[model samples]
Target: MISVVILGAGNVATHLFRGFSLAENVSVTQWYSRNLTTVEQYKNEVDITDDLSDLKVADVYIIAVSDDAVAKLSSKLEFENRMVVHTSGSVGIYDLDKKHNRGVFYPLQSFTKGAAMDFANVPICIETVDKKSYPLLKTLAKNLGSPVQKVNSDQRRVLHLAAVFVNNFTNQLYRIGHEITESEGAEFDMLKPLIVETAKKIEDLSPYRAQTGPAKRHDKKTIKKHLKQLDDNNHHKAVYELLTKSIQKTHGRKKL
Candidate 1:
């Protein structure tokens, strides 16, 4: 079995702990958090500690902390020359302290505390400096039924950027849609099916081909109406105008 020690108490760390705990081929040897109260509940299931000096030997040490804390935490580890990996999308593998073998086990998905997550559906992007560590990481990912993809630092950074557009930015757009619907006393729930279908469309068609709506069709009248509807909310107006112009530009149409 692949043994692991997970560090941090954030959303990503929590989800990773849940995924690992359910994996028959994986054993969570220990869990560490600077704030003992955050992970204290799991003490009965696995060793939980706030002291780095109290850490036990494990096949892998996963630093699932924030990006800014990764380096400092790695530097603080009392052991060296062992496989250590971080769960970060944008941080490079070299960000880890040079004392140990460095790698990344980035699960490319938006994580929220207490949200249900199936690692089987999450794509795990991995990068490793030590060749020997790749297979181990890959096996760990597969054990959770995740699709493993080998990506370098640059590729991972680009993926993270695209992810922000698809996940974060898209969610913001949904919030705008919610506000707009609520303004008219319309239920945002009505748009659920459309959102599901829009997502499913890309499964077979490329985003370019799946594109639809006024911006893609260059329906100036409809576009102008949308901008007018957002006139009361300048913040939402600017977002709408910017996205409309972007879609037009992508389709080789003149700026709206």
Candidate 2:
């Protein structure tokens, strides 16, 4: 069995801790968090320590801390060439330094604290310093029911940026849609079917090809009506106009 130690008590840490606990041949032997109070709920299940020096011996130390804290926390750990990995999408493997067998085990999905995660569906991006640690990271990812891919640091950075655009920005758009409906005294639930269908269509079709509605069709009348419906919020108005212009430009149409 592979003994693992996890760092942090935030969203990624919580998801990984629970997911790893469910995997066979893997035991989360220790958990390290600077905040003693935050580690209370998990202390009974595993060895929890606020002091980095007191960290228990484990085969792998998975650092699930924030991107900024990675280098600092890693510098404090005295693990002697042990397998150390971080669960960050944007941060590269080199950020962990060369004092240990470092790698990255980035899960390409948004994680929320206290939310149940479907590990089998999340794609895991793996990277290592050299060949020796590559297979180990790959095996661990497979045990988590994730499809693993070998990616370089530069490529991973690009993927991370693309993920922000696709996931984070798209979610923001949904939030705007929800707010718009709420302000108009319309149920946000009404957009559920349309949202699901839009996502499903994109699975098989390029977003550009799957484009519909006023902007795609250059329906000037509908576009004007929608813009008129916007309140005095300049930010919302600018967003709508910018997106509509982008869609039209992509489809080879003149600005309305």
Candidate 3:
């Protein structure tokens, strides 16, 4: 069995703890948080501690904390030469202290506290400086039904950047849409089907091929109408104009 210790009390840590607990070949032996109250609920299931020195021996110690804290926390670990990994996408593997085997177990998905997700569909991007530590991490991921990708630090950094565009920026766009609908007293819920269909289209078609709507088609009438509808000097108007221009440029349409 692969024994694992998870350190952190945030979204990633919560999801990993649940995933590991259900994996047939993995055992989550300990959970750590600087504040005991954050992880107090799990005390009945596993060893919980606020002190780094009290951690027990384990096959893998996962530092699933914030990016800034990963290095500092890893440096504080009482053990040495053991397999230790962090769940950050942008943070470099070398950021961990040199006292132990350093690797990354970055799960490339946006996590919200208490939101339901299936690990089987979440791809895990992993990297390790030591070749021997790779198999253990891969096996642990496989047991959670996660597809594994071996990526170097540079590649992982790029993936995280792209993720911000697709997930974070796209969500912000959704918020803008909500505000627009609210201003017109239109039901924002009516756009739900379009949103789902747009997402599903990318599954079988490249984003370029899936492109449609007024901007993609360079319909100046519709574009002008949209610009006029948005309030002057508003941030939403600026975003609409920028995206319209971007889409037009992408499709070889001249400025509208």
Report, for every candidate in turn, its global Cα lDDT versus the true structure.
Answer: 0.94, 0.87, 0.93
- Residues 107-182 of candidate 2 have per-residue lDDT tens digits of 8889998678999978888888868888877888888888998988888889889989888999999999988888
As for candidate 1, its clashing pairs are none
Q: Estimate, for each residue in 1-256, the C-alpha lDDT of model 3 and write its tens digit.
A: 9999999999999999999889999999999999999999889998999999899899999999999999999999989999999999988899999998999999999998789889998999989999888999999999999999999999999999999999999999999989888887999999999999999999999999999999998888988888888855379889988888899889997697
Write the candidate numbers in order of decreasing lDDT: 1, 3, 2
State candidate 1's TM-score. Answer: 0.98
Q: lDDT at 186 for candidate 3?
A: 97
Sort every candidate by TM-score, greatest first.
Answer: 1, 3, 2
Q: Stretches of candidate 3 above 4 Å error?
A: none
TM-score of each: 0.98, 0.96, 0.97
Q: Which stretches of candidate 1 lie over 4 Å from their true place?
A: none
Alpha-carbon lDDT of model 1: 0.94
Q: Which residue pairs in model 3 clash with each other? A: none
> Which 10-residue span in candidate 3 carries the lowest summed lDDT?
225-234
The window of 10 residues in a row where model 2 has the poorest summed lDDT is: 226-235
TM-score of predicted structure 3: 0.97
